[model samples]
Target: MYKELFIHRLVQSKEPNTLPKLLEGLFEVFADFQGITTESVSSTLIDLTFLEEIRKLSGNINIAFGKTLRDIKCTVNDSDFRKHEIYLRYDSVKKLRIVSVDLPSSSLNKQTYNTIEDVITAFLKQISNLQSYFNELENIDHHCVVMEPIKPLYKDDYRNIRIDDKTWLHLEVTPDGSATNVHLIGQSEIWQDKLQKGLLTWDQDKNIVENIYTIFDIKNQSVSPTLIPVDAARKQSSEDTIGPTCGICYCAQLPDYPGLPQPLCQNMNCDVYFHKNCLFQWLVACEGGRPPAFGVINGSCPTCLQPISCSDKDC
Candidate 1:
């Protein structure tokens, strides 16, 4: 039995640049499904359409990015041939559809899926390119910041984030400084209580005013499946370009910037790359006469007086 994963009500966009963001909002609306990953099952190739859309935007939006990414599709196989095929498509009109089907068995030796769960798991593995697509979608380039999951920034201990985790919350701080789309993961019933009463504050300074806390009211909150607008995800705009070497440490091998391969220079002129830790130490040193650093900063480009690359999305 196959069903249609339909994205309800399509919205037209005149600007291609805004498509990615719309796509983002679209997924946020249906972020409540539970998908599992299983290896043994034979599956079909997934659609690659939506992903192509993301790639184009990823190049322009330069926060932190992952090469891998998003897509659509349908088909059938014979009885014995237990084949699982999936495809992703992004039409010129801007709609995404994922359709699954089971055909009659072909041969006696071919394996067949015994249950829908088995089929679903195989389907997830095929479409598991989310981490990459999202990596770029939430590119700090699109907003004020993507608070790291590091200590003092964002902290959580609800283990079991595997592809199969029954209950989880994949929080993405929206442009409005709110986690509007809490990927309600596997099941909301399980984690709703904790999220409502948990001590979840955004910064190290947990004082009510100093910290950006998250309020969870499962009963009152409404985050419809939404679209991702690319207006907020474009690449560097000349002034944000930076050097190949760290202006401070003169280093190229910057510490791993999570999803990014290396640290980026935000200076208009390309000069250096730096380990974030190195950059932080340098920034701290520069603020010698200043008080203990408080929040993140978008330092000025030594040459242009503009903000540097990968510093802060808002700058």
Candidate 2:
């Protein structure tokens, strides 16, 4: 009975809805077979209808189907038996889909299958990476200290000393009652000098002494040797650049230390600079009030639009 109804639907319908109707008819036939009402079968088969659509869409097309479906290809034929290609692809979010049909190779051809395929592929890869990143971040403990300042040693010249942007100096207590100094940038002359001068002392036994010194400095001299946490320190380093004061805003202060507002770009690799907040407003005005995304803004220098690459020369 199901087969009879399926054939009838297939013969009557002019489009792909035939598959759905046939599946619906099958539920009715099965209901009769099991002595159940057709109305009950219709209500119970709703979810199955969706599954059937997925199966049918995935079967006839050369597509990849998993939790996400993609890369659907279909063949079309002309009246004269000439064949053409129709391609459909799922979007990056997997919420939208795009379809494209091949055009004849001509000078006026406005679209190409390769271009569509490339766009679909790129979007998928981007969304996939974003999903993976968020998933990984879910496991991260954001409450832990993200940044710490390395202690400056006596023999260390403060000129060439800069904090590394990527490397985190984690303080760990070792088994030998000493602080283990695991050099991340490897053996450097600056590091060696600092280690010898007792600036970068990781000795757990000396923690009390260091604490005393820090407290004394804070109490007596009004100087806190530790500038910022590891994360803030890195952020400050990235924000600081040798530049001129902004002509319009006159905010010329470079990010010499943490807890200070970052300056805006003065010019392309030139001196003029503004506060980050000021620059953001400037950009919004320049772009007619619709600023680009934060990721794009962070990715490039405001002055040059070149990619920002932070380096660790000193700290």
Candidate 3:
């Protein structure tokens, strides 16, 4: 009975020849599965190379510019690096986008970013430098009268610097610190014609702030005193009533003038002070709306009716 049971169990297990073949086939199947897994892991490593580098680079960036590093979004391509004054972000895994008040998405050259390390390094360097430039622009915006706020004056990157009523400059500052594009737009055809003929040129070596300030010479000029209202002027005048009042506005200081009313007349007999701007406009109106030549307006003083010449430069 034990021998019969043993034989029954052996038969149920397998035929010996068939069992070896089945074991060999199973081993081959397992080998193929292992090969497939190895190949998949190798492919995954190749794909995760960029991912790993980016993750490591992000760690470094978080350490360096922790304050400027506003947010790290877990998206495919929209991580932000916000600042109080500027709008900056990573437009992609490899590109940085900078958007300021009026400036557009200025990107560095593609060749500069070959690795993830390169991308982060370049972005941090650019943003660091931009802080100084942005400060300069803000200073100019608040103080400089020769130029309006640094804005895209024309299509694309051309900036406008208005030196005077009729004279301006269209300037383009490159993001990569390359050569700048500067074109002078002037008051008259002669200036434009000279620029076109290459007779008049802009010096690229000069600093932009220096160039604009030199054009109007506002750097050495002092900030104008705030406009004194009628009651304030009267109150101040009660204490000190020595200063000459403007012939036109009847105020001690004009709102937009850079300084006190100029003694344009220069005649001791008249002794009437007039804001250069007011005197110029009055003289221009008297002369049938034709401004005088050579930045000098030859007209009689309104109070004295004496021949007086006012320089437009003072205006």
Candidate 4:
């Protein structure tokens, strides 16, 4: 069933661009659905109105067929043109529209069409793999350290103990230099009843005052989540514009510093920066605990959400 179709103006090209070639290429792909050979599909072209709509939908005019074109107007070399916005519209049945537009004489050549066709073919192949494409989108919600915390210095007095021959004692020194140690009196049930929690004393400034200890209530303790500010992200990037910015935070600006851990996202378009400590905590928070370091792969730019890749050169 043929209906009225519209085509938009072609983009000005130094050589023939992909628009026309893509249309021709799609004819082959759609032929199977229409039960016809590529040659049998009519090459009938449409008008400028169609092109205008296409420009509206996709920000870029250069796209392959089967991709929905939006309604919009675009300017090429100061000339106004309209392109079809949506190409594939389904109401009750599927339909394909073809539009004809002028190609620059200087830009037209055999090679240009072939290149355009190749691009279209590749794009179509990707489209055919719908399940894979969706899988990628589904996987995009990921967490990574845009910034890692600098290791806090530990006090010299604190020492780890091997409880029994199997279990090791877990010890933590507080900011005030007070040490909290959990000891295993024994593995047996009777010995477990004899276990006692130990605490070291500290002065007003939090310095160790004495070795006198007491049992600690380890079960009732609550820790607060660290607050990460947006400004910190910018500061890191500002330190070195050349370095990648944090994907979680977008505040780092200009001339990246050396020796600092590389940022998560570096692309100028997505320019997000993060503090090392902030990022590490964020990863742990998102996963409900500290996750293994190796699981993280790619990270998204905090600003644009576009995936950022590691680069050898500074941004």
Candidate 5:
């Protein structure tokens, strides 16, 4: 039953120009399978890591308003070719409402579906579980957990979580049934001050901690950590010392401080540390005397042109 329905859909969707070639390939694989599953339905495949998907969708795709269209994509699940996971996408811009809902095979009843419409109906039901990536955490009543630690049992569960247009959180699980701590750019020593200047730029008065909690929808009433101590991280500069200076105001950066909002150069090779307000002023100045709308800047590093949201080597 599966093979018959599967081949019918394939023949219908193939380009008329290549019917002969498509049929040739289909015959070669036909004998290898006792049955076919939903994965055999569509050719569209996306191998995007959870983070890559978030970054790609973050600011690049504008979903605020547009004509709405939706599509469902079935990808070859890494675990099994005989099984597939369905992603129901509702376009918010050219296209963007994306969510992951783990639906079991039994829910789709692939073993007994009599028609293609039955297959589509199961995929469409995923709409009820869709989670928006564009809405603010507080608005959705969910916390934006910046790299929440993943337990062993839940290791496979963490999706690449995004906090804003620039912030990307990485969740790593360990063999010891533990997970890595949440480490943001400037706060981590990975970039090591070649100069990650003013990169992780937050607007007006928003600090990393505040932004993470507010962005991730971390409940204001609940306490969850948002920072991890990176090895050899540069600290608030001492005014008496002449080590690192702010690129914007030329003021010395404070060293060895906790929860400070001083901006780092983010260039990874420049020795510039900045006060949050100073960077804010510099960003505003770059925008040609125009104040940032809604306290957000089109912030990219002046030297590297990289997203100025974190000082990590990767960013």
Candidate 6:
């Protein structure tokens, strides 16, 4: 019965509603298929992800089957490639075109494929070759000996490279092998002030692996040994400190710390304090939370509804 319906729909493929209606009817039976599900992201685009291993491949895959083959777009799962996405489009009945195959870690030897499966397999093979590159990152982590280990963000090219217990370097290596969009994550005032004053700088022309060493050295050398740590500077009790309690936690000091919260709402009238980590979590869970850029998260202050920001790094 399903086969007959699908064949009839194909016969009337010129009808705008035919495919959707056919898919809708198929969902009644196919929705129960193990490991496969469909989602309509738009009138012409549908996304599907394999929940469990299917043919030894599993992750998010978006398939946009438009009226013509030229409009069809199939993006492979990019969990491993970071920002280097692999897009497959049906350019002809006998062949597929792979877009952006010039990824640094990917081999761009072939740009055309005879079949969708062939293109997917080729990309996956290229991505698998990046294991060595990932191992190189692990080696850098070992050499840096950061207080907190480095972490790779999900579906992102940036790495949160910890400089110390408080300071972090949010780094991204562009596809062309240049280090760009380097940002510092630390005490909001200290880092922002230094950035504005030009104390910290990044040279994008340099290689990312090489720049890591330079940036780490520059930041460390710029700091004074005689200066006291922020937590150490606070010799007073919570009651003695003149700071607003955390809007979310309602605590004067973050857990296990003697000093008051490090983050504050920007509003002059609503002087609220918040632990950096706490604020980040709250913002992420809140309704108007903006997505994370590098390591910084933007959201409104809970108390005054004023714009506020926080870093995800642990101090």
Top candidate (lDDT): 6
* lDDT, candidate 1, 1-107, per-residue tens: 01112322223222233445755654554343225211111122112233343445323122111111223222223232333343433222233333322211212
In model 1, which regions exceed 4 Å deviation? 1-243, 254-270, 274-277, 289-294, 298-315
- Total backbone clashes of model 2? 14
The better candidate by lDDT, 1 or 5, is 5
Better of 5 and 6 by lDDT: 6
Give one digit per residue, the lDDT tens place, for model 3 in 282-314. 888888988887888888889989887767875
Worst 10 residues of 4 by lDDT: 140-149
Candidate 2 ranges with C-alpha deviation above 4 Å? 1-277, 280-315
Task: Provide the lowest-lDDT 10-residue window in model 1.
Answer: 154-163
Candidates in order have lDDT scores of 0.32, 0.35, 0.45, 0.31, 0.36, 0.49
Model 4 per-residue lDDT tens digits across residues 1-315: 232111212221233435557444334334433454322433333223233334344344354433223211222221123222212221111122112222212111122222223333433343333333222222211111122112111112223222222222334333233345534311322223323422322233322212211122122223112222224433553475555344444434323432232323334333244544445545455457655456453444445665543322211
Worst 10 residues of 6 by lDDT: 45-54
Candidate with the larger TM-score of 2 and 3: 3
**Positional deviation of residue 152's Cα in model 5 after best superposition, in angstroms:** 34
- As for TM-score, the candidate ahead, 2 or 6, is 6
lDDT of 2 by residue, 76-170 (tens): 33333434344555332222233544331211123333333343344333333333222222212132222222232211111111222222222
Error of 6 at 225 (Å): 5.4
> In model 6, where do residues sit more than 4 Å from their true spots?
1-117, 120-155, 188-209, 218-315
Scored by lDDT, model 2 comes in at: 0.35
Q: How should the candidates be ordered by lDDT, best one leading?
A: 6, 3, 5, 2, 1, 4
Q: Kindly report which residue pairs in candidate 6 clash with one another.
A: none
